[model samples]
Target: MMSSPSPTTAQASSTAVAKRIARTARLALEKKFAVVTAQIDRELESAEDVVIDCFYNADSRTSQLNKDDEYVHLLKLRSRQPFSLVKSIVLKDGEYEGHVALIMKQAFPFAFMKLNMEIRKHVYEYLFESEEKVIRIKTKTGGQKLPYAPGYNTYNRAAILAVSSEVRLEALPVMYDRKFCFESTSILMHFLLQICDGRIYLTDLNVESYVGSTARTSFYLLANCKRLRRIFFKHISSNEQPKTAIKNFWNDAQPWLTAASAGQGDPTAALKLLVFDRTAFHFRVKDPNSKSTSVKAWQLADHLVFVKGLKDKLMDARKV
Candidate 1:
């Protein structure tokens, strides 16, 4: 038989074992916390890089930001955090201050309306209108569509219009004044749909036409544009049943001409010009009565001449 251990010895052994277990748990917790902190720091750094890139290379940076996992995670984390906690962490005096300031400016824009009217107009023109820049509506690789200024190498200035309703009301006319060039009638219609009522201010448009329901519908929508002044149609096909095509063209244009005549009280509101590709003049249509007879498409121009109110509003694209 062995002697029983003392109570004091047994108590001391139990305390020692408890301390080892406690120490291991503490170390594991500390390691996990350190890893989490490091990951947060990395995400912050990545977010900072994205913000900076947005100002310098907007188009590419925007695309990258949309796909970045770490940035997305940071956004979700920030959304979950309490406002006080977020402010204390993000607004601490350090490398993040500048980025925070930029974000704040965007979030809370200055009172642009307080500026003088002329200054506001100038700023709007500078951002939205340029003689050298023709805003081109384009589709991206992911099938997302938006307008861009290829000549200026920048995205469309429409972002400013979303600042506030006041800004949009003041800036819309200036924005719609820019000449928009689209690849096809369908793209033009899509843009018109996106802009909604902004079409009322549109003055200049350039587009390639396709003979189909989409083109007819696009023209029908355009007829409602009360201030449209000029439209340049490119690559119209002359061989597509000239008589029927000419009839459809006149029908599509009739609404616009009627509107222009009705708005004669406002001289500036009338359609000033309609330009078409020279190819449209070569249309050959078979006479319905004579099976073998083909007629020249000059009838299209002739029909325009006979319209009651249109005086020298039509021209070949080359003349423009």
Candidate 2:
């Protein structure tokens, strides 16, 4: 720690700003889960009025830009990188999908680059700090000392990158298979365990509840073994998912949100800080559901949050 506050603190906000970057991830993941669960229950009840076939065309639909808004702006043509620009696998549930998009870099097209090393993907997020070792300098206004520091401070930066090109699951060999969710969930658990060691918040764009499901569940998966941090989400989807899906998402995710949306002057930071002070904060995003993640994350800041849902056929691989 330093004795005096840094001078440049006034020039910048001096706080660790969560870098927002542009990205497109698996859409309505929680909703997908909810829908499938509902669909399954309905199936059990023999409810057959819903037409469940138009969602995923088993045969490759023409791959092109669908000109959709952010949340539903999934499925696009990649200008670069041969492997999946789309993060994870989109499983076709009987009704909708139990798809998975990777926030961690799934894998690089190493064969093209020929690095001869396995591509390790991770959602490495650091907010405003350019570097890891950020020291805060609290500012004082009234009668006396600040909280042992000044309101101004400075730090370097963290890894920030937006999805430069379009990412599409259709681009990758991923198919919408319904039988693989539980197994897939297990694999996701394994991957989360391997990379995530502590209570680190994994941010995401909430296409649904914005802050909760996208951010909380991602963090919870990582927090399974450890305590979790602030997992903030910015909403990026339209309101088309089943109402039950939305409710279940909120029901499961609100605790994290209520806790995460705690103190601090900046609503965003306060929302994010809610995670830091408590066990974990499940943040739904603030953006509209129609905004694309790439638009939201990239256009907003220098870095964006991505959770890597490992692309491996998780059933085959053992957790490290």
Candidate 3:
């Protein structure tokens, strides 16, 4: 008859089981993270901030709010890779409150940037903050002083040149030899719901944002949109690790290499604004013969410009 195992033997067996479980868990996590990173990279096929960080916080900014009650400014990543940086704005009672911009100078996108601001000590607080210190805004405390340092813009974030303008999406050149796979979301869920919910119309939505970095990637993706067709040069890069390297890589993508070559100095200037007309795009219900159609509205009418651009670039990408 086989003898019963000793207590030590039983303990050893349990430990072995635990080790196996841990190894399996690690493998599973590696696979999941790899999938997530890949999906993000594919989405941002043209973003300079190729690093990926979920920023899993409830608030985009740590803790700040302005008058407009816009507690959080959403930096929706149209592309999969993490953003090169994040530009945040704080408001109070529909008035200008404060701002911040996060950037990783040493490395590229694998780094994270969180620009948060609070309306405490509006003057000196602005004069000196960020590591690089790249802000110049007029404040109530005084003039010529950095009113909203570490912030995107003082008076209005929507006016920031990057976010406010119609710009071109540069093509990624420095791709890695080995590519990884990700199984996460390609397009941000928020923007998807915005277009699908009808809160923002599909035909009139703006592909660009007037905040941190330009929504050049959005325009690139939407360029191939159904209504207003477009084309772009898309590239894929390896999806791995701490993300700082990817961040840096994205900061230097070029458009000149691609035929669209939207000026060297202004990489995104060639956004090629199709100037979609709200009245022009007509929408109908599910039925082909249904007259249950509607025109666009002020905010809702601009969505078409956003999603359609994606459909366009996707269509004729090879030609680009």
Candidate 4:
């Protein structure tokens, strides 16, 4: 029989095998990433705004984007790339709320161009820099400090994008099927509220949901916004029921009227224009006693004229 190989030789062989496996895995991931990027580029060729939905299921081998006008194209990342990306970020419960959202300042089409190989290498290092480093820089320069805004310091993905100049991508760990009592609109709210700078022109406020006291929240949001020139509510389908909470909240004191009454220091005073789309105040109601509470195709829409009345009141108040 041939002499047994030395223990050192066997260890070397095992190390070689591990290296090969790692190389193979990285190459596979790179290929998958490249394919996804190519489809995104194709979408950018025609669509003005291309959104890349990196949301992927672990069990699924493909990531797809809806072909509708809402989304430009689909990215099928059915490989280790998605898993690897997930690993890069830490997941904490109740860290942020509502939905798993990424504060994407630049669309994926544009971000891809910005995050080249060389740039990516430095992006994470800058992002993960310590507070000590930040303090040192500030102390050395004694530069003007950033603005102090309460409920605005939480560093969500959007905040990271706002402050950083790195070629890095940030993702928030999302609770897909998990349910929570208080939905977290903190990230999106901060993003919307921070745009109050004089140079930023907010022409539209698209309300996506009305389930979670969104009306009241919106009331406060508009109360603080000074530069909003026009406002529009998202189209509400006839099948959707109007939230009683919203009606009850506004019943106490109409928001627009109250804002109009304020003498000064009221942000809503900047509002000179209001656009009411088809779904601005349209609501649906189904008889609860009916055996079938399902919404009927012929359900007539009832207009919530309360807002219209408030508008008239505001106009008269302004005239006086």
Indicate which candidate wins on lDDT: 1
Q: By lDDT, rank the candidates, best first.
A: 1, 4, 3, 2
Each model's total of backbone clashes: 0, 46, 61, 2
Question: How would you encode candidate 1's per-residue C-alpha lDDT over 136-220 as one tens digit per residue?
Answer: 7754444656544456556666788887899899999888987888887778877787778798999888987665556766776
For 1-320, candidate 3 gives per-residue lDDT tens digits of: 99999999999999999999999999999998766655433221323544443332233335457688866533324324333444444544444345333442233332111322233223223322333332222223444322222253334422212322221011011010011111111222233322332222123232211221323344333332333222222222222121332232233222211223223243233244233333322332344587454432323423444334433443344355
What's the TM-score of every candidate structure? Answer: 0.53, 0.18, 0.19, 0.31
What does candidate 1 score on TM?
A: 0.53
Candidates in order have lDDT scores of 0.62, 0.30, 0.33, 0.41
Clashes of 3: 61
For candidate 4, write residues 1-320 as lDDT tens digits.
79988999999999999999999999999999777666543221223343333433233434344556353334443222223232233335574534343333332223644566667544544444343322111111236322232332235323444434332233111101111111122322444344444113333344333433344554565554444455443333334334442345354325643663467554334334444345434344557788455443322233444344444545565566
TM-score of 2: 0.18
Best by TM-score: 1
Runs with alpha carbons beyond 4 Å of true place in candidate 3: 42-97, 103-320
Model 1 gets an lDDT of 0.62
Better of 2 and 4 by TM-score: 4
lDDT per residue, candidate 2, 153-226, as tens digits?
A: 34322212222222221111111110011112223333344433222323321121233333445435542321
Model 3, TM vs. native: 0.19
